[model samples]
Target: MTTTFADLTTMRVGGPIGRLYVPTTIPEAVDLLQRVAATADPLLVMGGGSNLVVGDVGWDGTVIKMATSEFDIDGELLTAAAGVEWDRVVAAAVDAGLAGLEALSGIPGLVGGTPVQNVGAFGTVTSDVLHSLSVYDRQTGQVERWTPDRCGFGSHRQSVFKHSDRWVVLEVTYRLRRGGQSGPIEYAELASRLGIAPGGTAAPSDVREAVLALRRGRAMVLDPDDHDTWSVGSFFINPVLPEVPDSARGCPRYPDVKGVKLTAAWLIERAGFPRGYGTEWGDGTVALSSRHTLAVTNRGGATTSEIMKFAAHIRAGVEARFGIRLNPECDLVNCSF
Candidate 1:
């Protein structure tokens, strides 16, 4: 039987795939890409499959599953291959007494995806410690290393690499602080949990443990037996607005470089789509995670269509209740709402 996206993605949905390639090395990945580029077949490059929502029709093209896992730690600098699991990298950093990645301990996905999404957790983001990354420019058929500025990072989870497959990330290097407390904890809940003031410091291991606990509490961490974890961690990006809307008054808001960021989960719950909202809908195969309103989960035997429908309902409800439109944080493949 042919493998399907449901078997690969964390969502456990989607349909059969046409072709798949797992490259164990950078050269092999490049060679595969070059060969695939010579054809008209569509290409989907995936890391951990944590942030993708594919249609039930499935992909009828080439799918490259990054499998290369190699990394090096030179003092405070850590360099990892694109396919290295993100959490493993964080664990390694913490073990080495590195400080920067401790707050992002339990985030899913791979090293290559960090720069693409500017992955963040309780307080720290990938860009906060990124030194540089190497990418293969599909357009030019050349490999180049780029600094943070060239990545076009934004306050929201965005970069030029996201939604565009022009640059294939090959390796990532992070500059962490050697033997020091983690960068000042910027997230209030995490700080409170650690008994530190917001913007205060904590030991790296302590921060990692706290972050893992926080993520586990919200079902953000992966657990094969838990249906609540069978979804993209956050299905919708926190909506950033120039100013807080009257309707969203008293909702949790944070200052951002672009504007004020409002919690998507807050809007989602207040819009009438509470946690476990879709459990009664359709075949009850998909629903908002009972642990968190931000995650739309696959309870069991869910299809891509069902997931999208549930998400669309949540988005529509939030938009109608608040004047803001919610966009998916996960990439939708071969489907749109």
Candidate 2:
């Protein structure tokens, strides 16, 4: 029996796949990749199946589930292989009395995926700590290190590797501080939860706990028993606009270099799609997570098409109500909404 994406992804929905490779070592992974690169069929060097949505029919190509787990700490510099669980790295940093990665405590997926989305929560972004990365080029068969500038991290989420599938991330190096103190708190909710003023710094362990608690409350952290946690994190990225439109006057927005980053969860809720919105909303298969509107969850036995339809409904509603198109944060694989 072929193990499909349904067996791999956190959402637990997808069809049969021909093969999914989980290499025991980096050399093995590279060897398989070299072989796959010679073929015309699609090549997906996937990490943790967090930010993915495959079609019900499934992918017609090879799926490389990144399995490397090499992580080392030299002074304050933390280097993690592509396959290391993201949260574990955060926990390790906190245990080692490192800072800067505290606010990003509960984020799912692998270290390799961070640069792709510039994953951020509270206020600290991955790029803020990212020093460099190593990637294997399928076209050139050369493994090279990339500086942050070459990655081209954009607002909300976008990178040079994000749109293109040519470069396969091998490992990532993040520059962290050896000091036990946390960075300045930038997210108001997090600061309030921690009983600290905005811009105030706390212990990394305290910040980690606070962040994890906040995530758990929203069901953003993975919980096998909770259906709400069976989601690909936030579905739509907060749309970074050129400027806030006059029509969206009351919408919560933050100023950025791109223009304005409007809160997508707020937009969805305001557009009339609230938390636990489903059943009567769609085919009853997919729904807005009971704990968070940002998560498009599989209620039970939901199909890819059902989820897409439900998302489309939400997107349409938001666009009609606010005149802003919501872009999905979940990376589409052999599927579209």
Candidate 3:
């Protein structure tokens, strides 16, 4: 039987896939990739599928799911294969008395997706802890180790492999500190939750719980029972603009190398689109997550078109009201704004 993309993705949308290939071992993965690369058919490399929005037409290519779940921790070094659960990696690091990854707790997706996006939360990013990666180079058909500097990580959600099909991550190695304490808290809300001043520290386990709690409140954590959690964690990447418009004087701003990062959720709220926008307005198939302004959720039986329409509606609203356009953080598959 052919499996649908809905069966594989978190958003639970998409049509039937042409073919699905899951490689459980390293040799098998490399060989499969090489063979696919030599073919004229298109290919889609899928991880946790947490960051995807697929259309009703679905993909017309070979869908390769990274299924190798293997990991090893030696002293302060942790090695994880592409398919290992990302949260599981954080938990293991904390359990082993490591500190670097505790702030990233409760993030969805598999381990390999981290470096591709330079995944970050709270104050730390994957690049901060990553030592190296075992990548299968599609161009040369060779497997080699790549260092952090080679990944081209900078600014919000980017890397050499982020949108490129030339490099496929097979495994990742992270360098962590051998302390039981969490890294210095940088997020004000998280710091307040831990009852610590900004820049203060907490135990790793404590940090994990606190982060998870915060995510749960925003419906960022996955929960099958909650309609609010039925969307991608955040629909928009916080827009980094050169300057804040006079109309958006009250909008929150953060400094970034790219310029000024505007708070997307704040813009959405200020634009008159509050949380649960669709439930109260249009067809109930799609709506803003009840807990998070940045989330565009599927209420029930919502099609990918509904999600895109709703997202475009939000983007257009934000632009008209604030003079800033929001970009989606989720990976759109066969779907466009």
Candidate 4:
């Protein structure tokens, strides 16, 4: 059956797909995924559809929507099918009085997508609690569990699943803390806003409340009626820049990737594209969220081309001024730069 990518994405753009699979069990998902890979049929594996931006022309391949729902909890260790909503997982952990996930309470998308991009917020990343994973490896056609080290988690990314459409996450295991409020506060802004001291602890529910409040204030929380949230969270990962040398300052020098990470939003604001940059919905067809400089929104009706064009404009403007190229945080669907 044909389904529009627009309907499958939070951005509300894109075209259609040739095929769609909604597997409800492990064997079924693995079987279909292997078949597609073996037959050389292009495939797109996705979760909550909260972090994608498909092209307007549509994907000419099969799209697998993981729907498996089996989940079990044992003490502080929790294993969930990839189909489970990430936020729901957090809620369950909270209900169980677990503490490690409270800082990540409001993030959208499914559990499987968490490890894919090392999803994080309020200074806590999924990698921090990851213990193991059940993944379908396309190369060996093996379904197996992987340790945290095996996942190759770095800042905002992982190694096991990057740049390759190979492994399909089936289930994930997390090691959560027991009988504690939450981790020590590490984000200055979050701590300040909550009137809590840095490195201090608070109830998990309190932490979640503060995070949701902050996200809502910035329009980072999803709202069906707010076009400002018609985005893929932060558009760019903060750029890590090498220390500036006196010689390089005379010319243009991008981040060395071995130095300190610079905030992309800070650079954008410095580049003159403050929050709510660009014409309402003209030219780039994308607008900076009026509440947050980091998000690029689809003003009513926008194509992937338009959104990307606006992104390019921001990247260019930032590079011209700071000599740093902001890499996008969202995965590009059927489009390349």
Q: What is candidate 2's CA lDDT for residue 223?
A: 81
For model 3 the local lDDT of residue 1 reads 77
C-alpha lDDT of residue 325 in model 3:
79
In terms of lDDT, model 3 sits at 0.88
- Residue 38 lDDT, candidate 4, scale 0-100: 78
The residue pairs in collision within model 2 are: none
> How would you encode candidate 3's per-residue C-alpha lDDT over 92-154 as one tens digit per residue?
999899889999999999988999888888988999899999999888999998889999887
Put down candidate 2 lDDT per residue, 28-108, tens digits, no spaces. 778988988888778877788889888999988888999888899999899999989999999998898888798899898
**Position 107, candidate 4: lDDT:** 88
By TM-score, the better pick of 1 and 4 is 1
Estimate, for each residue in 1-337, the C-alpha lDDT of model 4 and write its tens digit: 5688778777777888878999887789999988887786788999878777888888888999988887888988998999888888998988888889988978888988998888888888888899899999888999988887877676445456756778889999999988877889978888887688898888888888888899899988888899888888888877665565332344333333366556678778878898888765466457999999999887777888888788898998888887778898888877744
Positional deviation of 278 in candidate 2, in angstroms? 0.8
Candidate 1: misplaced stretches above 4 Å?
A: none
Model 2 regions more than 4 Å off: none
Over the stretch 1-337, how does candidate 1's per-residue lDDT look in tens digits?
9999899999988888899999988889889988998899998899999998899999999999998877999988999999999999999999998889998888888998899889988767789999999998888888899999999887789899887989999999999999979888878999999999999999999999998998899998999999999998899999889999999997899888899999999999999988888878999999999999999999999989888888888888988999899999989999777
* lDDT at 47, model 4: 86
TM-scores for every candidate against the unseen true structure: 0.97, 0.97, 0.97, 0.93
Error of 3 at 191 (Å): 1.3
How many clashes show up per model?
0, 0, 0, 1
